[model samples]
Target: MTEFVLVPGLFTGQAVWRDTAGKLAAEGARVQVVDVGPVRDLEAHIARVVAAIDTIAEGQDIVLVGHDYGVYPAVGAADRRAHRVARIVYLDTGPVQDGAVALAAVPDQELRERLAEDGDMKGELPVPSREEWSRWGSTAGVSGEALDRLTAHASPQPLGTLLRPLRLTGAGDGLPTTGVLCAESGATIDTVRMLLRFGDPTMKALVRPDVTFFELPTGHWPMLSCPDELADVLLRAAAGEGTRLEAVGEEEAGEEEAGESGYLRPFLLDVPEIPRERRGAIDLYVPEGGHVSEGTESGEPRPAIVFVHGGPVPEDARPTPRDWPTLIGYARLAASRGAIGVTLDHRLHAVTAYPTAAEDVAAAVAEVRADPRVDADRIALWFFSGGGPLTAPWLAEAPPWLRCLAASYPIMAPLPNWGVNDSRFRPADVVAHGGTPPFVLIRVGREAPAVATTVAEFVGAAEAGGAPVEVIDVPGAPHAFEGLDHSDAARDAVGEAMGRVLGRLGLE
Candidate 1:
């Protein structure tokens, strides 16, 4: 019989893996949940996993499973016992490289400081509170009784485990490996590969050319939220089935075909005016089944909204169907809520300045309008962050076909710091334009004070000019709060904003 060894992530013992182990055993595989007792350092944890593998009956096939912080030791043990391990599976995490620390520090500076202050007391990092869990942890799809159990078993994690770096000698390079990613985290296996291809240190050591990748649509804690599904994935990984290696370029196409919801489609928009190297593409999100007409006596095609993603930086501006999870989530939400969603990529600041991005947006709108499935006469424009400036022309001389314009934490005026010239990129200059369209602006009140000040000034100007504009304020939320923190406030803010836009378009 094949034996599977399981290692829990930070802040818990073997209890975290109990559900998964039970399910795996029910499926006829022998399972062992290793206890990483008193994780003093990397070496100590690895020893525990290695010891578990040793106890397995001789000549039996062995599969090793690791989750989050546990991935470091699991990979270490796989390296030390390569000849004995058959396959290694990683859940919601990747391997830590030889020279790199497991985690340098928490991503949020505020959270890191709090953890440091709290660590001084008990020498361990406390689990986040219920509010914090709602923003981050509660994504696992567990609720009611399951949630109660999760809260009861949660424990503090050791600081030593997080501080130490893993040491590897390439011993596990050829070991058969598989990675299961949490979709809510905005990461997919292909996205991980793309990050690794670009030389991301944290991902470089985890993914290899031969590694098979699968994605789970749940939150970080799959064991607690969806153990049966997690167990099934583990079975497939152990059997060496369910996924196959494909070239990076081909993965996106495959995802579209196998997309969770059948509403996603990709299109390449040509920008002959710009160099081919800088031309960008767009992704269309429509109702599942197919794009069908609505809102007319004869049921004419559905209205479309061109989505412009934020970013003046080259890295942030470039578009891929998989990257920008929040944008994709917004697009998916729009499609599900009865609007044809169009998201496009534009040239970055590195390629050219202001007008280039504007031109790309125009081209994308034209392409989307030309589609037979879209009602060109009822089009709208939604801009995010830096993409807001491109709305100047539309605001100054609104096209008769344009119904409305919406912005999220938009930069209404040119900032000298961003090298934006006041004369060309200013939205205030067009506030007096006679043909300005109705507008909706969503702002996070707790964002940079300068942003709030600029938006307030623009709202005042638009009101004075008699241009209809609606402002939705989400207090105590920071910029990009929807993606940074998946709090209920964030979801409601996005839904409310989209609802207002849809109503203006006569689609609601």
Candidate 2:
């Protein structure tokens, strides 16, 4: 028989697992819940879990299950007893990198600082009010009675637990792991895969063969809200029955063995290179016969489309987002269709750099408009990926000169974990208020759930407010479909979207 060791997060302890434990035991599986009573530090918590593991019958299949903050000690114990443990389960949590403190993962800087200050003074952090629970994670599905019980039984979490750096050895390397994501908490299997595509080294371990994922449609505390469902997921996870994520290159290599890299995939329509000019951080591709008459104003000022590439791109990333083939293709394509193509290198090198990056974009727009060969009154802004949120300010109050707004596989709202508290970047919220320029959104069917959810919300809000929105959806494509999907549908969608933006700029 397989034995399961359950661990609880901060505040509520063993009692929080009562329902889930009973369900697991009723199914004839051995269950043990760790109770590190009044523990002041993470080491003490780990010791308690380790003691429980030691009590299990020798050679009995042991699966360690961790919930929320409980994941730390559970993982620590797993590291100490990797050989004896059959598998490890993480509930609504991702792996904490070695030397990372639990408090560091809190997305809200103000809340994090407050918690730290209180923990330092009081020795423990107090439980938040019922209304404040939403800040931690969605409290949906949690019954009123359960909420009361949670509050009644809640205890202050030790400051040390949050501050202590998680120490890991290589003992648990390659240990079979299962992650149970809570969708209401704002992370899903597809979203994690999407983030991994950006090549974040910390999350690379998630795509390994021994790792798998399961998602529950409840809030952060699934044990309190959906104990039965949580139990079933736990059983399936212990049996190694969950979805495995493909690495960044795995799907492409399997689909197109000899083709160019996904990012380097050919553009949907073929267009000859236009005349190119480099000025500062901007690149301008002018259509044939379109030229600036030096020392004299040109007869006709062509409209221009400034393309803003997406990122949290590494500062050291070679060639930058402006030089990416996809951005270049879109720029050249714009020039082919009678509009000047504009691309620029923005400073969105990190998630926290949105403010500065937005400035770079505004400056780029100013520079593009000042060019004598470009129509100052007729200009369009097209953003991709992380650059999507930059559209929020314009959408909130569209300038008369801003002819159109376009986004391809854009993230309209910041992810819950990104810790972005700035309201300026939330396009969905701004669109809800109504007055906005025409929006051309290129949506993909296979987009990450988090990104897709934001787009859906933005469209819904726009429709509710009677704002104009034109959706060009590619049902079989992924997030970066321009380069990843080479089918007719992908090609047609790209061309149509570009034409729509160009048409808005009086370039039909």
Candidate 3:
């Protein structure tokens, strides 16, 4: 029988894995919960885990399961016993980079310093209060009775574990690895992966080509909140099965091919030397089997849609530019309909607002148009939310190659709170310049009163200016409705908007 070794995260004991272990045991597999006693440092933790792994029967298949901070020690143990390890399953955490001081820096420095100054519990970090636990633990789907159990079992983490540096060799490089990502923290994980890809050689090992990634729709602690589902994921990881747990209503009869989803298959494109010391990048979602134009002239390239994501937030809001998951879903929708979909990151707000964002959009458009695979003359611009204002310049003097513009519940007017002061930031004013491209405005009928009012005013102004504008209202949907609800109304609204865009461009 295969042996499964379970490791708990920081400030926790073997009890955290009990629920998951019970489920695994019911599958007729041997489950061993390694108690990483009194966390002192990374070295001590690794020693304890290695000792547990050593106790397993000789020559039996061993799988090391690590959650959160426990991943480091688990990886270290796997490295030492590569010959005996079959797979390394990472739960809501990825492998640590070599020579890294900690998985991540503690956010509250004052609290960290205070804990160190107190020297309480012989230097162990204090167990957080009930409120603190609830605030931080809520995201992991822990609540009510579960929250009480978690707090009752909570222990002070060893400061050394967070302070110690880590090092790794290629000893376990050949081992099969699986990453079970928590859905709520998916964006954070993507940001981490982006950082790893740009630099940081040590962390790059966590993103091996052979590693199968799956996203579980839960918070950080799947064992506590979703034990059965977590057990199923672990089983599939061991057997080398599915990459993702099907979302609601996504269950189909047949198995889906690896990396093949109904959405766009993303490929990264870097935008270098952007203004204000900022860097830009894009995720291009190309159609499956390539862009094959239908009913178009022979040898002509397929139409393309450039998607500008919303956000003009403070530069330090996130480590990198935010890529909207909703925009990616739309891009996939575009690709499935045989159009090249491009989602780009531009200069953020505060640092370089207004004209700078417009400049970035122009640069992105130029880049896309230059691509030989795209039909430059048949292109559209899609601006969502905060990105609405950036489309002002395009509407004012749209290039001949630009066929139309599409905005979804966009911020057409400026927000003084965000320091948007320039007159050009208003979409209505820009459309007054005339010669505007055909526009398709998607409004959420049940949107905030202010947003609905702004969209209505803009529509009136655009029509008055003799601009060929079409407004499609998705009744009873809120802002970013596509993400909020995937009802038939949402799908149909999106489809109708795309249909209008393609029809205007003569691609339909």
Candidate 4:
């Protein structure tokens, strides 16, 4: 049976499931991180979770679990799809509120708003206050690093959801409750306070009879706190072993499937240098059927190269983020060859900014080498346009994760103002977000001051420091000409260019 559907609250993404889902998986319960959106709000974000619940619970009992402000989406989803929903578990979340009372939660100077009737998070105004940053707010517990992620990628929500009335249909009729409260160090207390502070009259009017209240002695995010305990609770509910767990499913183990990978053998690598504290991560995106047999050379894991896609990405999708290059044909080419290619996100300013992007590359290389599916010493880092930052800092510091590195028309110099994700701010967000890879560089770009100067300076520093680095100007190539998805030459060249770097590193 499916264990539970856990939805992260505002400003959170699938990474929130990183720990919780890992725990649940160890226990034999099918756990999935409902993909909402890069943005945090109702309609778009909440609706995704609801739809996941509905799809999974069709004619079955479900324990709709939500954290913090995620309660509204959980409840709304359950209410709209009553026949399939069995119970809604609120993990340190507020109960459904209706009308102006819900709007009252928004502390506005001259006006008030609410999603009481419609149970919308996007539509409502949280009101500019420290509460949004304090423990009283849903996002209070996030680490500076995690919060930085939000600032880097989080989008603003719409206001309609806040004003909509939460009209419950028949779906929520028999929905039971399970409150996973976070109490340790006062986090749970604030959770409870917020529950009373924002819950609907119906929820606050009476202590829920069906609720199986439990508290964790941890911070706000239990997924990061007691993953094991949280998993057990979810399993109990999914298996109907708890006081309020939903009915068990008939399906047997492995009968359920996981979300298809964007590859056959996807990989995530995290590497960090001194004082960095090691949160940098990289992923080898694979589409279904992307890989075949392992490398033919005895037990070889096949040659791998970091595939750095070009330029500043859309607001919805950053340049080096997982979703950005997905639209381009870059990653697809690597997967087709049975090559374990890596795509990373790193920071660059004006672009993604400086140090933030550099940190990601440095960290990503360390991680890529550790992957069991990858040849530790055979990996190569590839880049194009503004891809200079990937290797510049790594070359400068040479924190020891590379076998080789490559670049093309990189906007090599450090940007003036990266703002929140500045080199002065944080660097990890950029490198991987911008496609950080491991190994020596294949630098390419116009020989103009815009590109040549920074690349030359960085490599000269690395080579002088005894780092293994190389550069190649693209003659007359424009800034990002060689990596454009629209050009077959760019497509063909990316792999061949990467192949040359790998060949030099003795991975061919």
How many clashes does the backbone of model 1 have? 0
Off by over 4 Å in 2: 10-12, 114-123, 139-153, 183-186, 215-219, 224-229, 240-264, 274-281, 289-300, 314-319, 345-350, 370-372, 445-447, 475-477, 484-489
- For candidate 4, the C-alpha RMSD (Å) to the true structure equals 21.0
| TM-score versus the correct structure, for each prediction | 0.54, 0.83, 0.53, 0.38
The number of clashing residue pairs in each candidate reads 0, 0, 3, 55
TM-score of 1: 0.54
Comparison by TM-score, 2 against 4, better one: 2
CA displacement after TM-score superposition, residue 255 of candidate 4 (Å): 48
Error of 2 at 31 (Å): 2.3
Q: Which segments of model 1 are wrong by more than 4 Å?
A: 104-109, 113-122, 135-138, 193-209, 245-508
lDDT of 1 by residue, 258-297 (tens): 2221112221111111111112487787655332226442
- What's the residue-level lDDT of 395 in candidate 1? 86
Candidate 3 residues 1-508, lDDT tens each? 7789988876678777778899999997889888876657877888888888899989777889988777888888887878888889887764565676542423243454555456443366677776665323224566577667777887888877766666678687668888887754332233333234333343345555456666676666778888889998888888776443221122433211221221112222211211121124666666655434567543467788888866544444343332444566667667666777777777755313667888878888888888786888889998976688787878777788899899988878653112234666688887765678899989987554434545777888887888788888888775556645566777788889988887766767
State the C-alpha lDDT per candidate.
Answer: 0.67, 0.80, 0.67, 0.48
Per-residue alpha-carbon lDDT of model 2 for 1-508, expressed as tens digits?
A: 8899998876768888889999999988999998868777888888898999999888798999987788889889988988889888988877865676777555566667777666663377778776666556557689998887777777877888888878989788778999999876667765566455445565566767778889887777888899999999999988888877653454544533322234445565677777569999999998875433233234578889999988777666566667777888999998877788999999997677889999999999999999998999989999997788899988987889999999998988776556677889999898888889999999989765656777899999999988899999999987667766788998999999988998898777
Ten-residue region with minimum lDDT total, candidate 3: 269-278
